[model samples]
Target: MVELPKRHKLEQSNRTREDEKLREFDEDIPDLRSLVIPWASMVIVAVIAAGIVLYNNHCDGEHSEDQLFFQSSDTMVEGSSYKESILERFLSAVTVEQHHVHKPVYEENHPSLFPLTTADRLGFSFVIIGLMVAAGGGIGGGGILVPIYILVMGFSPKHAIPLSNITVFGGAIANMILNVEKRHPLADRPLIDWDLILVMEPLTIAGALLGAFLNKLLPEVLLTIMLVILLSFTAYTSLKKAVKMYKAESRALREQGLKPDGTKESELTHINHQVEATDTNKAGDELLKDMDLQEGESPGTGDMESLAADKADELQKILDEERVTPMYNVSLLVGLFVFIISINMAKGGGAFPSPIGIKCGTYSFWMANGIMLGTIFLFCVYVRAYLVERFKAKERCGYKYVNGDIQWNSRATIVYPCICCLAGFFAGMFGVGGGIVKGPLMLAMEVHPAVASASSACMILFTSFTATTSFFVFGLLDPQYAPVCFGIGFIATYFGQIGLSILMKRSQRNSYIAFSIGGGVALSAVLMTIQSVLSLAEGEQHKSGGICGKDS
Candidate 1:
């Protein structure tokens, strides 16, 4: 108003614009702290109540000595005809053995709907908290779940593994519900990558089956040690990624002349139009530079407008191509599910009698596995071909890619799924969810945090539900407590998803998602190691039988 200098007026205008942008960003960030506490408390209380009932049953001696922990090595050696050498004894003592059979400790071992007890309340609280956090990261939290179920809830490994699967299935359902309609942050397509799901899930399931077989062969001590090491590494990598993202966001804020905290000095209205215009102009300038026109020539308004229109049309086409149709994907998945279930039901598993009476270690049982493997192999080949073709088409069309859009080239289609198979193997071997490994793997592949979370959740939905169904068939899931655990998982996950969404929007930091993943993995490593140590200290011994031998 007082005849300011041109430079001074320009500076003032720039500052005002920065403040307006910051305010707009901050408005979208809601205070979700209030919503978090109550939901978390409810989860804690529910799990604790369940824990009490389990603790009571354990105290009542419902669990046999073998069921309470692994069979003692000394007891096994006592029955052996030949005396073992020192090395053999050491190996036997240190080894962890898992059998295919699952005999329930009691006919009615599931917890009552609302049991009251004081035992393991703190452990129960941790389990609920871990589930909520893992849900935010699009994981099943099984790494934490199985360990807690065994160590604190007094569940045998046989029961705990299946229960963990059920809980993860419930959480996956919640995540899928939230993600199905959500759009990708940078594209018009759904956030859940159906293409990724189709390509990875079959191989993942196959790997899980293989891993479960290997689990019966491997020592528990070795598996436990491997899990701790792998999870610890994953946690470290995820946290490192989070830290890098945080620093990058801070740098961006500084470059924009805005405070990292998003505080603004002045209130403003109708800044959206200005911001859009500014962004469009910047984009146009970038486009013109990329064109590399004659040194003396500048883009005329008509030329610029034409280029912008062409760009818009190209973008529209890319989006249309990328938009997923669930029909084909779902069909393939359903078919795989049916085939796998059929095989498992026919061959029998653990305590669930085979419908066709196929005994374990028989030629029929191996044949069933062979058929399943062949089916998965054919399915993977088909999906891989489809993706490679799609990727080629995209390349030919000059597609403009966004962050986290996987270039499903032939090599990628092959390599990534193989990595996923390994991830799934670890999942089955350690009795955790594949998401615990795959979530970090996606991040390592440079997928956007939102896309990684959504896609991983979708994958978990498939894998966990499949495992849950198998457990249900095998009579491993506790009817009374299964529904309760599932409900808690659903509610906790719903709230966790909502809270993380708000926080990410408010802080404009995708790094929070990575942090959640890292924290969950790290917690799992500690919990599992503790459980293993406890078992070892108690002189727990596993029954290591031959692959084709009778179930111990």
Candidate 2:
């Protein structure tokens, strides 16, 4: 604080001024510069990313049609074009020849055999019939209606297949919407039999290719013979099942001590009376209750109670064993063989292996068919494992439920995927939707017919979608013909839906409705077989016109 000389004061004043300038410079600086550079870099990167996304979207919008075309052509390969062209020419030639021969008669007088003129009316009639069946409570009214449309409207199998495929697609989409609205979860998780699917895919595809090749090369007579044999076998199976069911019911009634005058009511009444008159309490029921209580109980029950409990346990164990044992194995070798043969038949002669002049290596329809079957099998195996684990978890938890509300054990669910895979493979292999297989498989799974139908509807929708995509990609979808097939099928599908709904509703009132539906189905199948055979014979006759006896 002491006063200094003039020279020292001047130097101190200069130092103070320099220090003030330095403090000012430090005050202007900010630590945020480090953060700002990184943040700005990040923002720039985000902007670039967004721009890329926008560009892609714009490009996609500009060339969507081209993309679809490219996707379609991916599976067309080398030889499909030539084969399709030849087939088209053949069909066109046949159509022209037939039309020329029939034109004069039609011009002179309206013939009842002309199925196309009333195709629309026939379709409407099918809708009405389907509605009537639904109101009356029958099974498969939709299935019935469409086949009627096919036969009555004079649609060929090729046309019918595409039409049916579209119908299934639309109907399934509608159902999916309805189900979603009802809060049913769409299955995102895959369920299937991987092992079988893996093995069968290659085999099935090989078969399809082999069959398609054979169809092309084989004589019409041989193809027709094979088809007839296959159809005969199918019919035999159906008839056998019907007969077997009838016999089983008869035998069951006899065992129940019922008279020859067959009445379920009488049999039920006798059984009820017998059960009611016997011990009011079942030994198993008491034993189960005891088992639940015994975990916290003393070492053992007294002698008499223990003896009684043991007896009950033994009886309960026996019944439990019976309940667990499977009565049949439809996923085994025999079933697999039947499924393969059925698939071959369904695909028709056109799908058989035929070597066109254009290609050297075998062109296989089975590549796709086999993949589908194999995928289904893989799905079944996966589902089986999933169900097994779920059952184990439930058992571990000892989850309880009211009677009839008991969760299906792993065993039941496991069986379904297997059954579904086999049936679907057969159906798809034959190029059919496999509704017959789906219906029976669903029923076998202990699902109610109504529920089965609904599920089948869902399954068919997926199958149609997959098949259509594959066919389209492979260039099997002829644009010129697609509209015709789709238009007729779409109308028919709507009609079928109406009819199916009516039949399902009516089924609750009549026990025999399913049987009646079955009869109709069988009849339609027979008619279809006859038609196919006749067509094949006609083709053969044309091929050997000079050698064979010709019409005068």
Query: In order, what lDDT does every prediction score?
Result: 0.67, 0.38
lDDT of 1: 0.67
Candidate 2 per-residue lDDT over residues 1-552, each given as its tens digit:
121333244345435544543453344223222222332343344335434433443345432321122132243324445323443322221111111111111011223433546665665466444433322122223344445445665555544454445544554555444332221111111112122222323333333342333233224554344434433443344344435545665676578665434545645555645553332233345334433423343443354356445555555443343233122321442344445444544432232222221111213333434544674455446645654564444332222221111133444444334334344333432333455434433333333333334445444444456555444433444454345544443444455545544542332112232333344345435544565566665662232111111122
C-alpha TM-scores of all predictions:
0.73, 0.44
Which predicted model would earn the best TM-score? 1
When summed lDDT is taken over every stretch of 10 residues in candidate 1, the lowest stretch is 28-37
TM-score of 1: 0.73
List candidate 1 stretches off by more than 4 Å: 1-113, 120-124, 264-318, 548-551
Give all candidate RMSDs, comma-separated: 14.4, 28.1
Q: Report the error of model 1 at residue 155, Å.
A: 1.6
